[model samples]
Target: MEEQRVRPGGPPAWWGHGPPWRDGADGEERRARWPWRSTVLLTAFVLAGSQIAARGQLDERAALDPFARVLLLIAAGQLLWRHRCPRAVAFGTAATVAVYLGAGYPYGPVLLTVAVACFNAIVAGHRRAAWAALGMLWAAHVLVAHRLYRWLPPSGDTAASWGQEAVTAAWVVAIVALAELARARREQWARERAERAQGARRRADEERLRIARELHDVLAHSLSVINVQAGVGLALLDTDPEQARTALTTIKGASKEALGEVRQVLDSLRTPGDAPRAPAPGLDRLPELVEAAADAGLAVRVEGTAPRLPPATDLAAFRIVQEALTNAVRHSGSRHARVRLTREAGALRLRIDDDGPAAGADAGGGGNGLAGMRERAAALGGTIEAGARPDGGFSVIAVLPLAPPHREEEDR
Candidate 1:
């Protein structure tokens, strides 16, 4: 997998939790607080507006009294708890407005309280409750305006016009429509937030796997050479001082090279999105692998030349050969290994073999070298096979595609 290119900044403020309004887990924004200041201001507006409206409807409706003021206050007060108890507040405000109108009080800002309540309920996912409340209030207003007005409060009240009823019905429909629109927008925002979070997690997992493969390939190959050289140096320390010094020198060179490669890998983490300072290792470095194996007492022969290839394919091919030879030095009894590279029309085939009689019981089931080799091949849309050869030898075979399976989309 390719390394991720992070943007030049820290993670987003809402990276883990999503936006502030969308912080709630189960639809409602539990962490977002409802404002009591708006509700308090609304109450003052409704009280003052009713008195002004009462003067215009003095001949048609009952005058606004202390009792009428109390009813308006009750309706507005219900909005304070609309977010916490949407269903209850929705029905409560609707019922209060119905009773005030039935008492022949002048029509005014009392209906605004019901609108606010229903808005909160619908946005909170209480659609049925909000719709039912508005329906009940409309039905009560119809009965009071058409039939009950004959026996109700104003001394000489007449039946209200159907025109007035049409206006009220239009207001109810508008509130419900507006609330439905808000609910849909809220749900859309939430879905987008969830998709972003899921994408982030998947990218993080892929990066972790890429880093693991890089570390295993570098450390395993270098450490295996060091181990073999250390064993040789110990055996020749007293018998052949000259050979012992050469073994020690090989160990130093191998360790230094390993440190440089490991540091390159670490640099990618610290400065993400920047091109690597040193070019990645590729098939051109096959000579280095051959010399390193010789230092560890293994003779590796190259059979075919590698052609110019894409960076990813070349890197994967090199790692596969390096890992296969490392496995031979650590597990195979034979000191000779042969690597044959075959460049086909669309793919590159690599085969590494060592004539062997198993070195130990855990020959094939050893460390992560083989697994890392297979992972590298698979990442390039390739395949790897490593096991005991039918002719009493161990072989690692890989087939890698020359081009990536698909063109990567450029970052937006």
Candidate 2:
């Protein structure tokens, strides 16, 4: 019934959405409104400037017309709501700029509002819409310019009929294209950030699965043997006092061993800041593990001397044997088992055979025990194959690399 607890500061399984405030109402309340506040202030400044320009145009000495002044005011007001509806604001501002220019309002600072609106529309992911708005503004500029100036070209232009409208359209198109490029760059950055977050979550999930598999292998075999011995001790308590006492002693020893194994498994979850403890069982503990299995009423035979292995390889070997013996005692109902460990050229081979009940003759008796053993071996750069023998027995075979293929040997 043990559960895995997520450690604080560990990488999250998934990236969170939006800003911190969007994640929770409480966070929203605590967040500062500085960005929005600054936006409002800047907007007020722009509006004030626009009003000043309008007043200057309206002065008696100024050559500006009244109609052009009115168009400038309308464009400035619509820009105040730009963030709410960027596309609409861009269209309104562009139209006003066209009208003001046609009415001879000097067409100077008034065009700045139209430029700002175009930038806002493209940045808000409305590139096509911004282009369409630009076209409409160009058409308006042509119509008004032609009507107000009596189809005569402006002072600098040659007296070509269609050249003025073409020049105006080109300018609007160039401005909109620049804004679209800026928007595209921003979108690329956002996409990169999203991809990095997704990769982090995927790696975290993989780590979680690996940890779960290791824990299952470590706990399953040890607990099964302990449970069987305890059951035997309880059963013998009434009929045979001496046998019962012996069984009880075995139970105590098995319980202590199980506790040590459990502690070893849990210790892996500790951080570097935590206190250190004794090292976990490795290849050195193989003989002791075999003895423990014998005490649990399974006769185990050990073969060939094993080479010195890395801690990870050694631990994987110990667990594989432990799981094999546990299976024999639990499912096979057999009293005898044989375990062989051999150091070959570049690999360590482990073979365990048990003459348990024929019915359950399979790797760790074909349940969680075998699956856990296979998982352990695989984690240590090893492979395991378990099945029933033709002679009414179960066998498990594992091949583990002594050292990683690409890495040089280090102090073990």
Candidate 3:
């Protein structure tokens, strides 16, 4: 049996890990492998420093005690695995340093090791762990200095040494804080990139929906009319040859028009580097559109003074009337439809009514044509009212503002 391959964009297995690559596989690989190399280098440096410290002691007993040196080397080497287990490394290093300090070992590179451990703890996303490490290290430093090295004054005059201790503490804290900030910045950048990718996917989905809606509106009404005419032509072929020829000619014209409309939509989807074509059906094409519907056996009436409209508004108006006429042909089964376009004050108004069946029952309440018209109107900051008129017919009235709404302008 062949193994089932996981196709791109397919659903994952039931028990699979979350998203497999939310941060991407490449980033996961980097996070998994790079830390070990840094850990190894850190261990080598720590071990070499311990050896040098064991050789150069102010006290003879401290220099002779090799076990102290060995323990210090172990503590330093343990830091090599800090990225893997930051909290464990931090506690272990702090304990080792306390023991070395209590045994009269000099505080040469111990502070540096503590700083590295604190930084690791922060990067591991353990804030409490870092605070605990800092507290433990400071307590151990004060206790060891007071009991063994007398780094603090014997007279308990802290002002003399407090400044030095405070400066050193501040340096360590600053380094850890900087490391934490860097980690936070990296996480923020990753989140921003993920959000942008999500937005792109969402936009692609919306574009696909828009195309599907356009295809449905364009094909549904055009194909319905063509189908009806073809049937009529076939029935009249022998008895009325002239009528049959006219029906056949109408069918051919409708098919050609549908093809051109589809091609135009597809061309709009193409990249800008491609050759330019005729613009989409705007107000300029209104006369041609009216003629086409008239040829389809619908006496389409146009009224009102046309105004200079924006490109988007003009496109919306064209599509609205196109869909309205298409619906009229499909649902009303009527021979006459009226379209009215008027511009008043700061708004444009469009009204399409047909003497078909009442709007509620057959004027496509939930169909694609009605939905497309509503979407087109809404895109132009407009409101559309489509329902049955009291005079036993369907009416569609849309009112669009000359300029987009304030909210829409803010979004732009």
Number of the top-ranking candidate, with TM-score as the measure: 1
Which of candidates 1 and 3 is the stronger one according to TM-score?
1
Q: Candidate 1 residues 377-398, lDDT tens each?
A: 8888899988898877898889
Q: What is candidate 3's lDDT per residue for 1-412, written digit by digit as tens?
A: 1111111133542112222212244434533654556566766776667557656754432442576667667677767666556788888887787777656655566656667777767655666777787778777766655554544322322222667568757876796787677556545545555565677787687677777766876787578668778887999999999999988998898889889878866875886346537666676777766776776667888887568887677778877887788777767756788889888778899999998764336664456677778877787779898987777678899887777665422111
The global C-alpha lDDT for each of the candidates, from Candidate 1 onward, is 0.85, 0.66, 0.68
Clashes of 3: 0
Candidate achieving higher TM-score, 2 or 3: 3
Q: How close is candidate 1 to the true structure, as a TM-score?
A: 0.87
Clashes of 1: 0
Question: Scored by Cα lDDT, where does model 1 land?
Answer: 0.85
TM-score of each: 0.87, 0.71, 0.79
In model 1, residue pairs whose N, Cα or C atoms come closer than 3 Å (at least 3 residues apart or on different chains), thus clashing, are none
Superposition error at 7 for model 2 (Å): 24
Return the candidate ranking by TM-score, descending: 1, 3, 2
**Model 2 alpha-carbon drift over 4 Å, by segment:** 1-83, 138-148, 151-182, 238-243, 260-280, 359-363, 379-381, 403-412
The window of 10 residues in a row where model 2 has the poorest summed lDDT is: 1-10
